[model samples]
Target: MTQQHGKKIMIVTAPANGKRFCGETNYYEQLLTAVANSGGKGYVFPLDKNPMDRKGFYWDAPNRRWVAAFCPIPDIVYNRYPFKIRENKLACKRFFQWLDDQHIPCFNTAFFDKLTIATLLKNDAVLSAHAPLTEQLRSLEQLRRRLKKYPVVFLKDIHGAQGRGIWKVVRKGKSYQLHSQRKVFPSLTFPALSCLLQPVIKQRTLLIQQGIRSLKTADGVYDFRVLMMKEKKHWQCIGTGIRLAAHGGFTTHVKYGGKAASTNAALLRPPQAVVAFIGRHVGRLLDASYPHIREFSMDMVMDRNRQLWIVDINSKPMSFDENIIQQKRIRKLVNIFLKQGV
Candidate 1:
């Protein structure tokens, strides 16, 4: 009932016409190279706007380059298309449905919702200890109640990505202050806080989460991007890299002032075992909904007390910055998809 996947793989960079390819050309090249070296062949293509069944950029392994060549429908589809909105379009949805009709496998692409992920993790007894207390802020009253419990709380977009607009609300005695980006608003009363957040909630959903005092870097707060891949029997950890937030910044997002570093993997050794355990649990959880999900990535942080917390998870993981981690991940991925033959 299913199409037997071959070694030939189709790597989709975007819904249509995105030569940028996740803005990590080097990573793309490496993946293609790995596939080539592994004896399985592959091609890179845009998801739409082109004849997906017949043309793509093939790897010129000998010359160490990509060549414009005619391609056939791949045995497997490895979706690298990262834009959530584009992938949600009617046209894109139809294409994915078509893949389903053809029985061609595209392992993952259910763009994660932060609230759903947090709530699911919070509900799991084994994972609850590592999950921060979070709730959907449907109204100012909800946020006010949360503030009563946690001294500092964070507001994150339910559907947001790359750490955008994650604001902080810190309670100083009876006064509350909202911190957005680098700007810190003056202390406000409960009514004033309600007024400020009313428009935001009206526009989109925001989840208020318990803000733990995390380990700080010289730049700002930092967290580990734990990369994990799904194998047939278990989840394989690719590697971990640290992302340091920009000075006085709220998140460790590279597009913002945050940057990646190899700083102190030793410090994370103890928690990584736990992280791996959680990854396996998450692998099973996601696979249930996504069917045959190949992999996922997690954003984790260590609190000042040296306790690890699970902050986020994404099915469509971006490439890691650390060279070694990226290299290891590519090899593991190639082995997974190319085991069958091009």
Candidate 2:
């Protein structure tokens, strides 16, 4: 692959030292290294900076405005801002929409905005084929009815992320308890359960879904995080990784005391069909998500019978080390900008 001499890639991300810091290493640092090694200039725009502050073609940091680079309207603009959907949500939505309206070549369009993802899940075909079977129920009676049919069900906030607001409910004897319901791993005291649920309901969009029994590992329950990316005309599996919950854990969210391991580690392997099935549907889901959405992560699980289920689809997931396995994918994304003839 020959280097394109003058194309530049611009990155827009949340500030590293902000109070509400996103709890992960910034992938922009890695991207900067990649761009430098590839013989291209990478421009990073921090969210803290003022859009009104500007200078010549380059962003004038001193003035705090966007600068028109001596290149085309940024060969590519990557939106990697940190946003907790449950907190500071209004601001997040506004910023993302503003970027979409810019009409520059970008990824993860407003197509999967907070409202749209919720609405699309209501469609039977979309629900049955891609999303885990889920429903938003408000009262104890409605929840009890659903609990009887499914051994374990998870209560989640529609806009929640990083596993901050998830509760697993199950029935025990005559009374119900909120515990780590998947495979009866452990229990949380009833009072603690109520505390977790109270704020989630206040958020006004609470959902419950049948829990997929997770694959057990020595460390804890775990699931696969597959990296799906689009390069030119093809959908490629750039890399895959595993997130393992600490011992007796129910949710394997990295932000919630979980750890990462390679996808092929001892406890992470699933059947070939399971992997292939996810790749197929996830590709379709991304295709339907947006004609221009390029990359995202899919949380997947393999059931006892080897059937695969998509636990969640993340539009802008943590991307710390994914580019290592397939540096070509990063190169391809960079190439997209270079081809703009900027």
Deviation of model 1 at 223, angstroms? 1.2
Candidate 1 TM-score, true structure as reference: 0.88
Q: Tens-digit lDDT track for model 1 on 1-342?
A: 222334678787652344523435667778888887777678877656443444567767678776876666677778777776677877568767777887777867557667777778877878889899987888887888899989899998877778776889989999899888767886888888888888888997788899988888565788888888876657777778788888888788887788886655434433567778878887777666666577788888888778888888888788788878888878777877866211
Taking the tens digit of each residue's C-alpha lDDT, what string does model 2 give over 1-342?
224665556565554454322333334444555665656666655444344231113333345444444333445566655554422456545544554576555665432443345445546363455456677767766666776777778887666677865778866654556753343433544455556566656666877888787667766687777777765655666666677786777777766667777645777466655565556555665576566766767777767665567777777767534447546556655555565321
TM-score of each: 0.88, 0.75
Q: Name model 2 segments beyond 4 Å from true.
A: 1-3, 16-26, 54-73, 84-103, 110-130, 179-199, 262-264, 272-274, 320-329, 340-342
Stretches > 4 Å off in candidate 1: 1-6, 15-23, 49-55, 59-71, 263-269, 340-342
Error of 2 at 77 (Å): 0.6
Which candidate comes out best when scored by lDDT?
1
Q: What value of lDDT does candidate 2 attain over all alpha carbons?
A: 0.59
Worst 10 residues of 1 by lDDT: 15-24
